[model samples]
Target: MSNSLTVGVVQQPAWPDKARSLAASEAGIRAAVSQGAQLVLLQELHATHYFCQYEDPALFDLAEPLDGPTGQRLAELAKELNIVLVGSLFEKRAAGLYHNTAVVYDRAKGRVGQYRKMHIPDDPAFYEKFYFTPGDADDERGQGFTPIDTSVGRLGVLVCWDQWYPEAARLMALSGAELLLYPTAIGWDPNDDDAEKARQKDAWTIIQRSHGVANGLPVLVANRVGFEPDHSGVGGGIAFWGGSFVCGPQGEMLAHAGEETQQLVVNIDMARSENTRRIWPYLRDRRIDAYGDLTRRYRD
Candidate 1:
């Protein structure tokens, strides 16, 4: 593992057309590589628009197998650029099952590992529960919440909704993850007022930054931008607030992008995690024995 790592986060708008969406993603990847980024991350569901805005059986057609064309394209990009890449996909695990999955590709190594989104949200506009099945808790290799080992570093990659959970970050850190990453597709309802939008965006940003401060690891977030209208017309469309960013171990902003199609290339000092943890020591003071109630759905 190197003492420093150069990373990239691509935040772009998406369309229902897969070809057009991927072209945008590829352009961002190329731009990042030109700036010496060794690892790159694309936002969640970059291959298509936010289809989960409404539940329709037809949307299942949007999903592909793990080694399908989208995955292959991402793997090829990783090899072509000689960089480790993280990309999100809507996976068709089986006939009646699907998942929001994140895939990792190492240069020349092909598809290395994957993490299925564990938290499925069911809200008015973001109806993810109708589409995705949560990841298994314990697989043969202990997959859930496990960090993926890569040439760049051990990556603790989680999807959008997972970012709101501290347990997920803590588990990844406990398993030797060096950095935390979120490939997210979160936005606000267009009908919301400006004050409400600000509150929502601020809360989202603060929660993720707090994850970095608590875990003593860098956090990388890539979120889509632009307004994506709900085709079903059941609700007002979402205006994706594209405030993609990179923060250091101390929750200090390294780089931040505005609400536009942008790619951020930032150098992360890997040594900071060790130095920060040594002084903060949040991990060492954990009262694990007294936290057994966390497993229950509710304590009442």
Candidate 2:
């Protein structure tokens, strides 16, 4: 595999309509491809605004099957652009069973792999647990940190909340993922103080960056920007801090997007992970035999 690949992260506002949102995303993906992005990653729930703000049964209708229209559309796009595409969607498996899933389309081989969001968060505005079922424990369908093999490399792709857990990152690395990619939709409550917002966003970015350093791989986080309204139609809802960035193996920022704008492309040398790991060698010195405590829910 080549050590360098150009990737693009699309950070744009979502429209209320699904068709319009899909069109906008397609346009963004095409534009990224035009700029020479071999792999394109979109923000979480890119086809719609963060609709988990409420627990209405009506919202469940938004969920579509993996082979449904949405996925098919993206597959067509992948074939058209001849670029690998990573997309997140609200998937409807069966009646009353839904999941927050990410699909990776390999341009060379077509639809190849997918990973469901494992860690569901039930925060005030982000009521994900009520909607998505946690991924099944069995690895039959390539769940968990099993990286998807593509033309570029094995991609350790995970959703927003999963990025917070070190176990997820470790498992992906153990499975031989060359890079970690997070398709995220995170932000701060409008009512929070600016200082608090800054702290929260900074902490979020730093945690993911640390994942790169700890596992000796690059980390890419694609977050949504702009504000969406709350369920109660109140004032401004979560203002998605759009600091989508790419961090090198040593936790150095390779590329970053602004807080309130749409960034098209960010290029990086994928081979940097190998050189950084050769110098730092954290993976070479792991004490695996002493990590039994990690399996326990809590060490009393």
- By lDDT, who's the top model here? 1
Which candidate comes out best when scored by TM-score?
A: 1
**Tens digit of lDDT per residue, candidate 1, span 1-300?**
999899999999999999999999999999999999999999999999999999899999999999999999999999999999999999999999999999999999999999999999999899999999999986875469999999999999999999999999999999999999999999998888999999999999999999999999999999999999999988898999999999999999999999999999999999999999999999999999899999999989
Query: Once all C-alphas are superposed, what RMSD does model 2 give against the true structure?
Result: 1.4
Q: lDDT per model, in order?
A: 0.96, 0.86
Report, for all candidates in order, the number of backbone clashes: 0, 0
Off by over 4 Å in 2: 234-236
lDDT of 2 by residue, 148-256 (tens): 9888789999999998999899889988999899999999898899899989998999999999989888888889888888866744688888999878888888888
Query: What does candidate 2 score on TM?
Result: 0.96
- State how far residue 281 of model 1 sits from its true place (Å): 0.3
- Measured over all alpha carbons after superposition, the RMSD of each candidate to the real structure, in angstroms, is 0.7, 1.4
